[model samples]
Target: MEKKLERIINNYLYEDIKEIQKSENLRNLGLDSMSSIELLISIETEFDIQIPDSYLVPGTFENFEKLKETIESILLP
Candidate 1:
């Protein structure tokens, strides 16, 4: 799941991922509102899940791990 999430993020992020980690904040990775929206759309399309706007807060997308966890929670439960 982490790897897949990483791939999705990589498709949108322009930064070099050599030193990137799951714990790193996505905003720190240069994810502005535009890229964030793209990511949300990509996640929905890839996972076939609808993430409610209530879960679209900054904390949910704070990092790769957090985003992965949030998505898993929605999909698994």
Candidate 2:
């Protein structure tokens, strides 16, 4: 599941970037509000996890990894 999420993010982010570890800045990699929303939706579809609206705040790719973690905890729990 982690690999899947990493793959999805890597598809959009540059390859040079390290795998997301809950601390990387996705925004610097070119993520935006719409992209974030789209990514969020993709995660839900792929993992069947319902992400909270709170995780979507302040739209930034940098926040993406954390969002993934948040969703993962919910789905895996």
Candidate 3:
């Protein structure tokens, strides 16, 4: 799941996956509002899960770990 998430995020980033720190802000890594939306769509499609409206916020996409946690919560719940 982590690898898949990284691959999806890599699609929108200029940096290599290895260079991205878990604590780094995705927005600073090149994810803008539009890309964030697209990223959400990609994640939903890939995971076969529809993220609730409540999860659609800046904080959800604030970093890789948070995004992973959000998806895992929905997927495992």
Candidate 4:
């Protein structure tokens, strides 16, 4: 799942996961409103899970690690 997430981020945002800081902000990664929406859609499609509005807030998508954690929480028991 982590690898898939990284690939989606890399493909959509055009940043290499190996080069990205875990704490780097998504906005700093060049994510605008459009890309952010596309990223959310990609996440749901990749993981085959529906993300609730509660997880769509700014803090949840703050960085790569946070986004991974958010999806992890949703997918894992």
Task: Name the runs in model 4 displaced over 4 angstroms.
Answer: none
lDDT of 4 by residue, 1-77 (tens): 87888889886565786697878888887888788889999999989999999878888778889999899898995
- Residue 42 alpha-carbon offset, candidate 1, angstroms: 0.2
Residues 1-77 of candidate 2: C-alpha lDDT, one tens digit per residue: 75687767765665434544456678777666677778778877888777766656664345555656576668777
What do the candidate models score in CA lDDT, each in turn?
Answer: 0.83, 0.66, 0.90, 0.84
Judge candidate 1 against the unseen true structure and give its global Cα lDDT, from 0 to 1: 0.83
- Kindly report which residue pairs in candidate 1 clash with one another: none
Residue 44's lDDT within candidate 3 is: 96
Ranking by lDDT: 3, 4, 1, 2
TM-score of each: 0.88, 0.70, 0.95, 0.90
Ranking by TM-score: 3, 4, 1, 2
lDDT of 4: 0.84
Best by lDDT: 3
Instruction: Please identify model 3 stretches exceeding 4 Å from their true place.
Output: none
